[model samples]
Target: MHVFLIAALSADGFIAKTVDQISTRWTSKEDAAFFAQKTKEAGVVVMGRTTFETIGRPLPDRKTFVYTTRELLGFPPELVEATQLPPAELLAKLEAEGYTQVAICGGSQVYTKWMQSGLIDKIYLTIEPVFFGTGIRLFTEEITNTIRLKERHLLSDQTTVLEYEVLR
Candidate 1:
């Protein structure tokens, strides 16, 4: 299976102001449409517990999976499938279940964890036109691996979509 990180961020590389706050001001309608289209292409979407909580719930159209050590019995079962395993084991189980593509939707901690684990094959990042100097970063300081840009698509409103391959 192919694992990829899919997120939108400020040009300065921050995903949000905090784990619980999402800055939707910088996000354009075009970006939203594009993201929805791309998200639909994936068979499965996975994220951390924090991200799941931040977003409030799983997206309706796709099969959503959340990684959390805590019990998720209280969450709506129809919208999400919760698991407690680490990234590698989670991916292995998904692959064993015959899932072809998995998208990692995030908050910083989850992004850092998956990136550091070398479980992500590609990343799709939408760079908004603004920057937040005090927000949470996309990756942790421990990630030292280099990523090669495979492609870039410039949108009409100065926003950009970057596709990168995680180099080993």
Candidate 2:
């Protein structure tokens, strides 16, 4: 299955101002539309518990698999499922369920874990105009890898989307 990490970052390289901050508040509408379109095409999105809680609901027309040890309340199992499965195992399970691709929608730890697994095929980043100065980063820990740029799009006058192929 194709697994890609997608996120919108501030020009300073922060994903959000804080753990509970909603991305829509800082990211452009064009970026929001881009995220919806891509993840919808992927048919499934995987994120951490903090990211899931920040959104407060499962994305429409997609199966959301959240990485969490405890149950997430007030959501159907089909629409939103909590799991502890590692990246590869989860992707394999999703593939068996007929999903050809998966989106690693994030919050630090989740992104780090998937990248560390070396299962990420690509990365899509929307860089917005503003800077948070310091906040939650895309990955909580250090990461070193080479990725060649595959595509770029101007989401707006100030926002740009960069797509890169992982060079493992």
Best by lDDT: 2
Off by over 4 Å in 1: 23-25, 74-78
**Candidate 1 total steric clashes:** 0
**RMSD of candidates 1 onward, in order:** 1.8, 0.8
The best candidate in terms of TM-score: 2
- Pairs with backbone N, CA or C atoms under 3 Å apart (clashes), candidate 2: none
- lDDT computed for candidate 2: 0.92
Candidate 1 local lDDT, 1-168, one digit each (tens): 788898888888888877777445567777777776776787678888887877776676877888788878765675688886789998888789777888888777778888888888899899988778888888765887689999997866587889999887
Q: lDDT score of model 1? A: 0.80
Each prediction's TM-score versus the true structure: 0.89, 0.98
In the range 35-67, model 2's lDDT, one tens digit per residue, is: 999999999999999989999999999999999
Positional deviation of 93 in candidate 2, in angstroms?
A: 0.3
